[model samples]
Target: MNYMKNKRVTRKKEKHIKILYIIPSKTPTGPHIAILNMAIGISKNLKMKIFIITPKSFELNYKNYYEKLRESASIYEVSFKKQGILYWLSLAIKAFKLALSKHIDIIHTASLKILIPLGVICKLIPAKLILSLEGNPLYEMFEFSLFNRMIIILNWVIGMRLVDLILPCSKWLKSEMAQYPFLQDKLSFLHNPIDFERFQNAKPRGIRQEIGVPEKAPMILTVGRLHPVKDIETFLKAAEKTVKHHKNAWFVIVGDGPLRKNLENITKQLKISKHVVFTGFRHDVERFMAAADIYVMTSVYEPFGLVVAEAMAAGKPVIVTNVGGMPEIVGDAGLTVDARDVDALAEAMLKLLKDEELRRKLGEKARERIEKSFSAESVGERLVQIYGSLLKDERQ
Candidate 1:
């Protein structure tokens, strides 16, 4: 008992900021990637200690990445089954105990579901609750399943009541939440940061030759999950039109999803298989982006297009749909087209392909915009300000 008391006293005196980061999984998906980057940045830039809290269902691969992260932080696994009242009750109990025992100063969640109960539980203990709203809760819920819609609404209500801070990835997302009167003053816009230096240093070499394209072939590249929202079918159909005129040009779609076979079948049916290459889930996206002449994003809805910013950072001209946050991210650096119009997309791709000077001008502008707003250092500074604001509020 005396030893335990002395340990608690020592911890309180040290007063290290203990942040418990909760995420759904450790996958290479969007939310996971964004949170992992933030955690790494914070660990390197600040003196605070971070503890990653993930569900037991999450796989523990990528030891190399985790080892680097663990050098300055710690990790814990908690089981959180997404079903039944009993499961939720158990999860709440476990999380509450972890927060209390670990002396967690901040409860930070990347997943939307954890925000409600986790925030409430922490607030009862008076721990700070910080939610990184990476995507739109309402839109993402409806996109996944109707069941999620109910959960999203419930969580949104509780989140507004309990969360101390809201971090949105884009202005569009912040505007969307502003429609809800409850979230007005609580919302803060912070776009996910990109390692601009790494992207800028990437060399565009050998990819055209390895992918079997002609040395001078202009390649249009789209890198993302092959989902319906991504509207890759539109890009593929547009490629059919593009290839009819630009015979030496090629369209490369990198990344994978449930729709791979469907997209492959469409390529065969369109008879443009020879002009298109579906390189499923290449880990070397930087290498692919380096080789590509143009980067395209046709997502019908994107909370924030990380890859679009990455492309601009790489000094590649971009073509994206004029929806969600794409236009804001691209600014005047790239072309925007109607999401569903095949001919329009085809025209933009072809226009950039033929106009080398136009591409160079756009690419230069794109890099400049990213340098001003989307660099990792800029994002880190914004986040630290948010954390300081929350800390100030708590003291008062």
Candidate 2:
């Protein structure tokens, strides 16, 4: 009886694992939000103690998320106007000190910039370093200048080799990373989690009325920055053809970027300016998802489209480009068309718009997919299992 009682006590003592999440972004983007969501999920579903470190601007810009995060983890805010070398050095030093002071078991981050420096620091301590592959770093470097691209590549090479484990957000990303022989052993796929409750409970805020679309008009929505990689041009081209078949259909683009003016000009050229509404960046995306009859994503490259999952959680049928992880996210629940194929995109949109029964069925399946496989609790449980197995191997 005493041996059994002692075993229970030992198990109870081993339950808590100290984890520190370092987020380098000052602004709230999809990847940052995804990491924060996972942190919150880890705290809720495990006996783990969570710590988060980010720039002060992040806390200020994402007040609601900060508040939600604070309830689950301890937050350490730093000041940085720009992400220079000194800023990264300061962050690494801060993280190193905090990890030691708190006895952090694992240090996780989504930034390669953070991973390379922190990798050196983790060697001085007992903590394991984890890098979350939120996007394809190599592909993203094409947008930068030649000098900056080389610098980013150097970071990727060093960071990929230094981290103990690499968690890609999708199987497609894992396959991409596996091309590197060194990363083959460390790769694991972890899908980004959606706040199922938030999306499921979202109520329509009359976005259609505010945008001047009739109440009964079929509203097709796509949410992403107006960037070339997002392939918003293809969405517009498809919108042009889709409107020809269903003149009453409205296409709403819910983000802004460098390509806004060019995209608007294309709409004018196609004479479908009246059918497309660019709603800039919106915080009430769930509401917009609620108001939308269909959700579409046309990215030529995406690691994992969190917005697509959010839309699915909101019970909206999705149509995504057959690139990266989007087809994986949509699975059999919705349609997948070849990237840059305007006719295929238009046909998919028209099919969903024309058949209310098919849309309803797809929407139902989409929600079921999210609930069964990608909920916060499920993700948190998977994370805990990974941590446990890693630590167990270390002990053995």
By TM-score, the best candidate is 2
Give the lDDT of residue 35 in candidate 1: 69
Candidate 2 lDDT (Cα, whole model)? Answer: 0.85
Worst 10 residues of 2 by lDDT: 3-12
lDDT of 2 by residue, 1-396 (tens): 664454334544565788889988887787777778788678775568999889988667877678777777888877778888788888988998898777677898888766677888776765688888887788788888897777778878786777888899999999998888878999888898888888988998787788787788899999988898999999999999999889999999999999999999999999998888999998888888999999999999998999999999999999999999988888999999999999999999999999999999999999999988887767878988887776666443
* Residue-wise C-alpha lDDT for candidate 1, range 1-396, written one tens digit per residue: 664455445545654667777765545566766666667667766647788765564445434347557687677665645545655566667778888777776877766766778877776655788777767777677666667677778887776678877878889989988887888878887788776876777876687777777768888899999999999999999999998889888889999999999999999999988888888887568888888899999999888999999899999999999998889999889999988989999999999988999999999999888878887667766666666666654443
| Residue 192 lDDT in candidate 2 | 89
lDDT of 2 at 284: 84
Show the lowest summed lDDT stretch of 10 residues, model 1.
Answer: 56-65
Q: Which residue segments of model 2 deviate by more than 4 Å?
A: 1-14
